[model samples]
Target: MRDLYERAITAGGLHVTEGSKLWEAYREYEMAILTINDGNDEEKAKQVQRVRALFHRQLSVPLADIESTLAAYKSWEAEEGNTRDPDSQVDDVPPNVLSAYKKASEMYNARKQYEDELSVVAESEANKLQVFLKYIKFEKSFGDPARVQVLYERAVSELPVSSDLWMGYTSYLDRTLKVPAILKSVYHRATRNCTWVSDLWVHYLLSLERIRASEDELRHVFELAIQCSFPSMNEYLNIYLTRVDSLRRRMPTGLDFELIRQTFVDAAEFLSPQLGIEELLLLHAYWAKLECNIGKDIAAARGVWENALKKSGSVLEVWQHYISMEIERGHTHEARSLYKRCYSKKFAGSGSEAVCHAWIRFEREHGTLDDYDLAIKRSPLV
Candidate 1:
């Protein structure tokens, strides 16, 4: 009967890790026998062995969330004794306990020796950083949250000026610890130590978003990030995008259109110095689309495209977007006139093929057959 239950459990648990009925029944059966005839010492010892053997066997297999088995094992150890002696022979110990003991002893020895090994070879900055990274990774493998944090703290204490170390430390706190206060605290500490690293501030804002902070809170964070002197235009763009995305999702009432408009303007101003004319053209196009889509401000959208074309009239696609916007607003006549203006530019950068093709498509869609034919015939060769 035990053999039959074991076979079914093995099959059922092959793909299971938690909340398994087979696991519960097995543990309950062992517990029931162990509790009966409590006065018989030899029988009780044998019953205890049967339960211990069950845990050992269960531990040997790849069970997910071993917290249950590990906790049970610890309880059994409290009742019997801890089997964590390094020099003790494995032959006398149960198989599961032996495996756990060997792993624990190995980890203890490595941890005990790590400091001595580091103090000798950490002679240069590069070498010391490498050793610290190895130590941090080693602590992580133990899956002990406290030890991992201690190692991170130790690394940061010695290398607070190192942005890489600070970043790694904060990321561990954010991803592994997943404690909001701890994440926020470390990010604050990290930014103070490495204010020049813009990505840290970006990540801070994102973490706030993840916790579903208020718009006022997000605005405060964005303002704070802007106040940081080390941010580049690209970082500013990211901050703006994050804010816009969060607000877009919520679609809350009393949204501050003016603040968002100012963000777009500020982004263009800050980035104009770094971007070339062609890049600026695309940037304006993107901003125009944002105004159209997010703000539904058609006048503002038209203003952006007009400004872009006035500065970059030579580009074909910018003109296409401008005319498309007009057409989209039901101004087919205006779109046709804009197409004529585009052809008249005859700018050296103009690829006449795309212009003529677009013109033909526009006329065919919005004008009569006569208008379309006129477009194909009157358009110049590339």
Candidate 2:
């Protein structure tokens, strides 16, 4: 029976730690044994030593009601007819041990109010979530990492479908713990519960990449993310962007550009109905920039921009972004040509004036004096 109690205390982990009744029961059992051998002075001495040993052990652990246990131990010493203080009677006791007990008692007292509030039955899941969040915050601020993790586990178990709770837990694990296996487990569980949350899937994919998981593993998770029925086109876009970015980061020089191009194609096909002109243009811009910068394939980049123009040629922002990209890549002639094409087009937007000013600025910086003069003359016509 004593062996069973030891197992419960040691192997039960955090759940049996905070405010467990096991300590009290164990102490009572020791006292009962002492009572059974009442008149044997030698046996009584041994029992007294055993009881004191139990108190000393309990004091070292940071239990929730440590102060009460300490008081009980002192009272027991007094009842055993020890006149001196309990601390002085224990010759082998370390000074720091008592100081640590006092610190643990203070920590428990500070945590009691939050624990009390959390124990009450909440009216709704949202209220419960708020309470749990507050408790988690308090634990993070004042308690050890183990306590914080336990609080997160408790929160997620009760609010499994809460994306916010899952996100917070996974994020804390990612940022604080960085234990790959634990992170993978929590992410898998979180995604299973909140599959519709695109951000969670995105973060999961990034985490897998961060830990340098195999290419097959990363692709498998990305496929799972794509299969989720996300609420918006942007969510799908984010997943695609994250996957491509991860691929780029993993193999910056030897990346298979064809695979990336196929990803862009797949994104376009999957998101066509929901993709607005601006989103379409932004997607093409990202693809073109990757081609120009990473692949060093100017032709492929130009092809992407031309495809974007076919889709959103009338949007002034598209022209500006395309021209800006060319200028940034030192393709001055291409930028000038783009500016000319944009000026010739009769797009419906109030940004035409802004485009003309940008063109004038571009020519002043990148073009010759005669070219700058020509741009100034052509600005009003544009």
Candidate 3:
């Protein structure tokens, strides 16, 4: 996970100033180990020595929480007073604990910080979220999952409509904290607050699928996701397709190909006015390929292609693919007729060159001299 984060931060063009979040987190992880207590004196002493040395090693360079960490180190030495020879090795712990040292470092400061931030949130309406964000990250840095959960809950209560905060909170629980019950409750609430966002719905459904929710629960999310408020049919179609893609890839055993086909048909029908004839035709075309590739329903695939072309016959790629399917099935007569329809359409879309080339190639390989001449003569370019 550390390697993954390093790569992500480096790839993201994070400056030293921007990377304080990660440095703070790393420092917090090491600090948590300072509190562990073992039975054997030798092993216990060895462990404390190592952790203390670690603090010193990191002190050579600056960290995001250098003052807080140094203060904690000082408090630790004061607590370990007179146990070993004073002159044996490293310097003694400093005078005051960093923010009350261990107690302050662990949880005491978090409550104080939260209260402080809440007071500010109530006062500042405009750019006030940065305060709550600071509190949440501090809670997360300390390694108490329950404390983290409470902090997130309090955060979203004040800012119900912010998608980024909700996503970050839910993601922390889902991935870092690993509390399913908390995650589910939060997702349910977040969707209610953020009804108009498509990607939020996608992420919510993806979480459901990741946890392998019941088919009924999954369907419930899917139903809600399709109704999300996108500006256009094109955007709505993209969200609808994201749900279908999850079913195809993630839940294959329960994958009902018929349900998938019906979904495409209904989506096209439901939004056809905004989609227009061209977009609707394209949906049917993709559905045909899905049938051929995944459902292995060649007969239904061919049926979709033929039906779509009859209603909307002008797209060049669709015509080309239809011709290939017919010839692949040894129906040269059918292929020849489809090619004739392509010529009849006179290359209506922007892909005339590719379609004409495909026609010429088909005729040279499968057509008579007369057929070859017909293809060249009817070319739109000519």
Candidate 4:
């Protein structure tokens, strides 16, 4: 029976209050034991100590009926002849115990204010979220881990689809607790509840990587994330980026180089059709850079850029970025050839003018005086 009560009170999320029905029942059980051991002095003394201990435990917690419980404790002490003066009952308690009770009572009162506000905002999710956030802040600063967790559970239960609440809870677990199983559990639930949130998926992937989860597990999560309907194409892009980054970090020996390259290729193929020209070009640029830096395959990088140019060759941005990549890689001859190709293409509005200016600047920086003079002569403005 005692074990049952202990388990209930200390359960992962149970919040037992002082002077509640459970406390009352526990105290009555102890009193009944005292009655049963009336004739045996040793047994009676043990029961008496048990009752005293129960009272002390009850008094330590703050509850609405705490004063009544204290009064009852004092009366019991007086009847047992443990107190010299019934009127000085407060004096019978130790200074630290009394101080602890007082502090608990004050904290309870402060917490009640937040609870009241929460009750009033029950119909408004936005307001309720605010209240929960404030309440969580209070608990984090003044309460124990269990209390904070209980509050988070409550908040998420009421706002199951709220990405903000899920993010906060998962972040707290990741940052403060660092318990892998618990973090994994919470993250799993968070992603399930907030499936549309790419950030949550990204964080989940990162968390799994942090704990060294198996590759199959990480791939399962990544697949689940890509299947969700995120609000923006960039969200999809971010998820792909996080997956690639995880693979890179996990395999420093370049064992996963082909897999990483395949992921970029997959991202480009999957995202290109859904993205605007600018976004498509951005994706290609990222893929090309990855090929150059990590795969050490400049030809493959150029292939990625060539694919982008096929899709958006008229977009000056694509040509400019391709030229810039070549320049950055010290492929000066390739950059000059790209500039010549760009100038040969017929551009609308000031696109041709922009290319002319870029070519002149490039010649000045990387070409001889003859090349610079020739570029100046070829400029339409000149």
The best candidate by TM-score is 4
**lDDT tens digits by residue: candidate 2, 161-229:** 999999999898888888898889999999999999999999999889878788888899999999989
Better of 1 and 4 by TM-score: 4
Q: Choose the strongest candidate by lDDT.
A: 4
Q: lDDT for model 3, on a 0 to 1 scale?
A: 0.66
Candidate order (lDDT): 4, 2, 1, 3
Candidate 1, 247-316: lDDT as tens digits? 6566566676666677768767776677665566656766777788878888899898777777677877
Off by over 4 Å in 1: 1-106, 121-123, 229-232, 277-282, 324-334, 348-353
Error of 2 at 260 (Å): 2.7
- Backbone clash pairs for candidate 2 read none
Instruction: Give all TM-scores, in the order shown.
Output: 0.64, 0.73, 0.62, 0.81
Pairs of residues clashing in candidate 3: 71-98, 74-94
lDDT of 3 by residue, 325-368 (tens): 77876777788887766665556556667777777888899889
Clashing pairs in 1: none
Error of 2 at 139 (Å): 1.0
